[model samples]
Target: MSFKALIVDKDDEGKTSAGVQTIDESRLPEGDVTVAVEYSTVNYKDGLCLGSGGGLVKTYPHVPGIDFAGTVEASDDPRYTPGDKVVLTGWRVGEIWWGGYAQKARVKADWLVPLPDGLTTRDAMAVGTAGFTAMLAVMALEDHGLKPGDGPVLVTGAAGGVGSVATAILAHLGHEVAAVTGRPETADYLTGLGASRIVAREEINETVKRPLEAETWAGCVDAVGGAMLARVLGQMKYGASVAAVGLAGGAGLPATVVPFLLRGVNLLGIDSVMRPHDDRLRAWGRIARDLPMDKLADMIQPATLADLPELGRAILKGGVRGRVVVDVNA
Candidate 1:
């Protein structure tokens, strides 16, 4: 009846600290289901929650993992029963509620999705929220008429989680992938993930005087956002769609309307959190069927609950590459 979890707490002076602690079962949050968590993952939001709350975590003694995969231990919801495999992402669970940085988690059944058939719990965590958002982006692009033969698909922030998965999935689907990264050292790694070309971060990260450049990318999965996204808009082929997934570069978009007005370009905003159940199922199914497992494996860097505090900080600094799968029980 007890579980181990990484708890982040703030002191009277406003300093925040995080560490693994044993928690009683009675302390679990109100929910229809209780899960024996197998794996969880660190995300940029997790970093904020682990630290000063970043305006995302509104309370102390918080659990910061944004996504988790596990098996149901108990359930009041008819859709799930004990022993059912499940996954949780978004819904601000880690920020506004207790989350899966624990050996056990209690959550609303509505926020849980059955793990796709081909992906193990570990694989689910490896993909995490970042990869899930990436899949949504790709689906959005496809829905807007993007095709493999049209031209190369650009994946900005290619060495990071969303970009890495997007590059791999796009490449496996026969699209030529152009990966953009600030770190030149990751070029070989990106190539191994099926990127046909590596575009330096400098090549496309700045704002341009001309709002419409020579139309280049047929589609884009942009995780960098900010100026990079603004610049990418100008480079999109006529009527091409760019899926905006993150603001790692920044949140402000200093952009002009020329790309949208003159070229009929579409900017699609992707939000994995608060996604509908049907969309979650569709994305997970596509991930299992289209994303190459070996590539996902290569993107994984394993960690334990004890490793979260440091990993959380690292992710915020953009020092982490690929995905970090955290084994909560380890």
Candidate 2:
């Protein structure tokens, strides 16, 4: 059998190009299960893999989708059988191994999770790795004692995938959500996602001389690290927590300990990749129970496998909003 895939290859000059191509079943990577992939979504890492490899994709002619949802076509593992619905994320699948930018994917059974009861394969990809990570962040915050009505919860980079999902989840949970975005045009969009306030990127993105400020926010899900994180540290209310998710702004944290020491503010690092199976199940279950389906639907922008190359570049440039669900078979 053969399937269509977005195959990325590098030339002798080391430049990379990606396009949809027909792939034989014999070419599938070694794995315990074979999935007929229904949907995949573009993430920042996918952008890198689609373009220049981003130091993540090591092999040429690689498939580059970090997350996917589908039905099992075959399985050697006892935990999954043919016709089982499954989802794959993390474990560096797209980065170090062949991934799900195709009509089919073969992967280790350990990396696959049964799709949560309420989410369709399309909905699973709509949440993708970005939204999954966002769910992890929210869980981390809650585990660290964050609660609704403590004060306003902040979501930085609110228009991006992680931030968008975080904002919606926080709002649905009864928190007053303050969404931060550089694009003023997205204010209405954020509001529709239930954000009570829109904070301009300029309002909290820069480094501040003061280590502690008004202590405004009760909790934060910060996607933009670097200076924005540092500034947010000072603004968090005493005893508050911040789940550090992405470093889209930058990797460096130019911060002080005043917020941690004096205010007892906590900084919780969230890592969705390589999470334990039980933890993955917990987060996905929470997502199905807590995250509103309508909000997730609103976040979706549909695409096909042929649309990936352009969408991949757009995500890297921070030009994509909400979620982009790719129908691999379309």
Candidate 3:
């Protein structure tokens, strides 16, 4: 059988090009299972893979989707069968391997994790990789002894997927939430998601001349790095931790490490890719239970495969808000 797929390729001159085209099952790579994919999503990474400067896809003719949820159609592994539901987030699937921007995908048995009990395939894709990373950030804070009573938790890039979900999850858990964003229009959106305070982007991006500021936040989930990360480091409460996730701002940390040394602050780096299978499952399980579904309705905006190219540009420019759930078969 044949199906519609999005494939990017490079020609003889090494020029990159992408399009939606028809492909046969024979084009699929080696795997233990073949899935009838129902949903995938657009992440910052997906935007990178689709964009001209996005470094995610080094090889041509690639299908760039980092997150997917579906049912198995064929399997060589005994643990899986045609009826089981599964989801994929990392293992560098979309970057190093062919991913879920197609009707069907064949992947290693080891790369698959059973969908969490409370989430449907659609719901799973709604959370996607970004939400999973947010959950890990929240879990990291929890693991480091952060609690609601300790102090307010700040979520930078609060309008983005990871930040929005992180804010909601922390607020749902009864913690005070301070959401920071550059767009003033998104203040209500962030407030609606349970943020108790709305902070300006400029307040978090200014140059840090001092080693430490007033003990501002107890913990933080920062998706925007660069100057934003550097500023947040100084604002944290004594011995508090910050989970550094995305690099939407920039890759460089241009500030001193005086906050870390002076206050006993910890900077927890979150890398969802190459994470142990057990940890991924646990994170997904927590997301299914903790993240508010009704709130996700506002955070989630659905798109088709055809919308990916435009979204890729929007996300890179920091224009996108919340999760972009791609209905792959739509």
- Top candidate when judged by lDDT against the true structure: 1
Clashing pairs in 3: 8-61, 9-61
Global lDDT of each model? 0.94, 0.93, 0.89
Model 3 lDDT, full chain set: 0.89
Error of 2 at 77 (Å): 0.6
23-106 in candidate 3: lDDT tens per residue?
999989899999999999888787778765366677777887888899999999998999999999998888878898888998
Task: Return whichever of 2 and 3 wins on lDDT.
Answer: 2
**Model 1: residues >4 Å from true position, as ranges?**
none
What order do candidates take by lDDT, descending? Answer: 1, 2, 3
TM-score of each: 0.99, 0.99, 0.97
Q: Write the residue-wise lDDT of candidate 1 on 184-300 in tens digits.
A: 999999999999999999989889898888999999999988999999999999999999999989999999999999999999999999999999999999999999999987899
Error of 3 at 184 (Å): 0.6
Those runs of model 3 whose alpha carbons end farther than 4 Å from true positions after fitting are none
- Pairs of residues at least 3 apart in sequence or in different chains that clash in candidate 2: none
Candidate 3 accuracy as TM-score = 0.97
Position 102, candidate 1: lDDT:
95
Query: 77 in model 3: Cα distance from truth in Å?
Result: 1.3
